[model samples]
Target: MFARLIRPLGLCLILALPALVFRLSGIESDPLILLAVFGTGVVSASFVLAWAAEAAQVDISGGLAIAILAVIAVLPEYAVDLYFAFTAGSRPEYVAYAAANMTGSNRLLLGLGWSLVVLIALAVAKRRTGKSIRALTLDSGHRVELGFLAIASVIAFAIPVSAQIHVALGVGLLAFFGFYLWKVSRGDTEEPDLVGPAATIGALPRRQRRVLVVSLFIGSALVILACAEPFADALIETGAQLGIDEFLLVQWLAPLASEAPEFIIAILFALRGNGAAAIGMLISAKVNQWTLLVGSLPVAYLLGGGGVALHLDGRQVEEFLLTATQTLLGIAALLALRFPRWAAWTLLGLFAVQFVFPGQEARYVLSGVYAALALGAFVYHRRHLLPTLAAPFQDHPDEQAAKAAEQESRTAP
Candidate 1:
């Protein structure tokens, strides 16, 4: 009883902390104070969101559950970036900041976030399995995510070439995301392997469990929506007050706050030896950002009355190209449904190159490098590519059928 109450009580306190701070200080207080208060709230909300997602696995297929979790986890990033895009309509100067925030968040997830999860998984695997683990092997069912991500990557490369995002592009991306959700929803359900607060909630009787899930979802969503704007605005204001580059602050600091909770949740999953789910959640997140988040930007701009299209200046163009290429490289690395240690390090090293050489030439060079690596990987895994692409449209199969297919692929000459 005590152990059960501990996690629930702690989660409730975390969820209340930000609201308490906000009520006491108000949004009109110091920028730094607002940042601290709202930021803390977003983090607490993330914990509840994560546990809720884990518990939801009992009601949904693992794939669909992670996909839904990915959507929720990225809500903060969407909140911050969308705010920038929408505000950019009235203040054209904010256009670049919007692009900066989007590109920075995407790169950060693949670079730092993905790499950290992989490393943590490797460490945990070594301890539990009594053998070194070089890579994280994903279930074949994840082909649905990888395939859709690949398609989205191909479409994203066109954004830089076009120099603007049109409403048509937004529709296309949203359509793709909708199709993905529909496909995943039909997946076979499995018994949820729960932990922490999620396990506590999952153990309840049906009615009680559902009530807790609904309560958690509503509570966390409300907290995030309430705090996200203030937290984002405070970051920009604090940057100006401190003489920091506002664009850099929006690009990095804002994402750090919005993304920190998801990162911690993934790390927790990794530490528990559930590396596949951890990586899968992040991969699903990448797809969401690449599609829905990117798609919604132009819509937000238009809703703000910016123009018929959202234009990308030279810097923003470079950022988009770099982000798209990085995504391509990441998808290619996971072509075989495996994320290797060397690949993780390579991603981090390339990401680190930006800070070391912050020049236009470096940006172009990195983009070319990523594109080349991606091409090489796609070519090497050409044999497996077609099947992966077909996975989403293929009929759902039972475990035995999936295993048979896996065996056939391996045994083929």
Candidate 2:
């Protein structure tokens, strides 16, 4: 009893640290900053609790994590963009900035995060003998769904940047939502089960689920908003003082800090041997950012003013292109279906190359390269794609088999 109580208390403390840091970061204490700090503490603790509850159930779903992380991709935009949109009399610029960030974040996740996972799997190949590297098979449902997403992603990219993104984004989001519902309703039986004692574990109680969901929603909102103010402000002030580009500080450093939750959560899931969920959460985050987050910003800006515009100079354009290209590579790498050591190296290579590249044309070229790689990989794995897509649906039976097999293995030994 004491142990259980102590664990939760410790986690609460851990989550609150960010908010505390935010409060202490600046000498000038804005009242809103104070409010954000308090709110963040509450929200972070709630998300931790929700995560714990899900882990306790031994569930490996990625939907919740994806949704939560996606919120962060937009949080920074909303926090700063909204302020400028309302006050600067340049609502269009605010919308443009928000859209750019969302799009950029999505590409980064796909290009960097996905590629890293593939490469990491190879480096850690011998770490676990029980898990299979070729475990990701898409079922027909998933295939159809992913096909839609692929098309949507492509179409979205093709649309001239100046055009309204609302319709495209709305359609893409609806498709994803529909796909998610179908996946969930099919039950989480799409993979081989983990070896464990089934009788001792029980289904999650509704009350606990409610507590977790509510807490996470409220806590995340408050925590992120609170952290954003200080993080963004610090980046601007410190960068200026240090003779660094203020935009660089806010754009890059701030996001890395804000993305800490997703990073921590993904690592936790990976450690638990739920690679699919871990990877899926990151993917979902990209999808939401690319579609919903980017889409909503323009609408918000328009409401704030009659027109929205974000002046993209050459440097900003280059960064945006680099982001998109990276994402294309990551997505394609995942579709490869085999986790080779080289895959990981390539992912890191692509990410590193883009990291240093300084022009939009260069990024655009790399993105094309990424697309070509994906196409080739898909063709190479054509025979296995069906089985891979169907694997999630078949995981239920495999899970039961693994459980039964484990029991027998233990008995025999």
lDDT of each: 0.81, 0.49
| Residue range 1-413, candidate 2, lDDT tens digits | 22343455457668688576756675465544544454456445444533443333334344344343344434544465344333323434333444344544554555456555544443344377755454332222333234334544555553345344444454555555555445544543333232111111213355654454455445655555555545444544565566875555445444444454455555555556565555665665565555555445445555655444333455555555555555545445544333444555666677667558735676777767766776776665454344444443453433343344355456643
- Candidate of highest TM-score: 1
TM-score of 2: 0.66
lDDT of 2 at 378: 61
Candidate 1 clash pair list: none
Question: In candidate 2, what residue range of length 10 has the lowest lDDT sum?
Answer: 193-202
Q: Estimate each model's TM-score.
A: 0.89, 0.66
Candidate 2 lDDT (Cα, 0 to 1): 0.49
- Report the C-alpha displacement of residue 16, candidate 2, in angstroms: 3.5
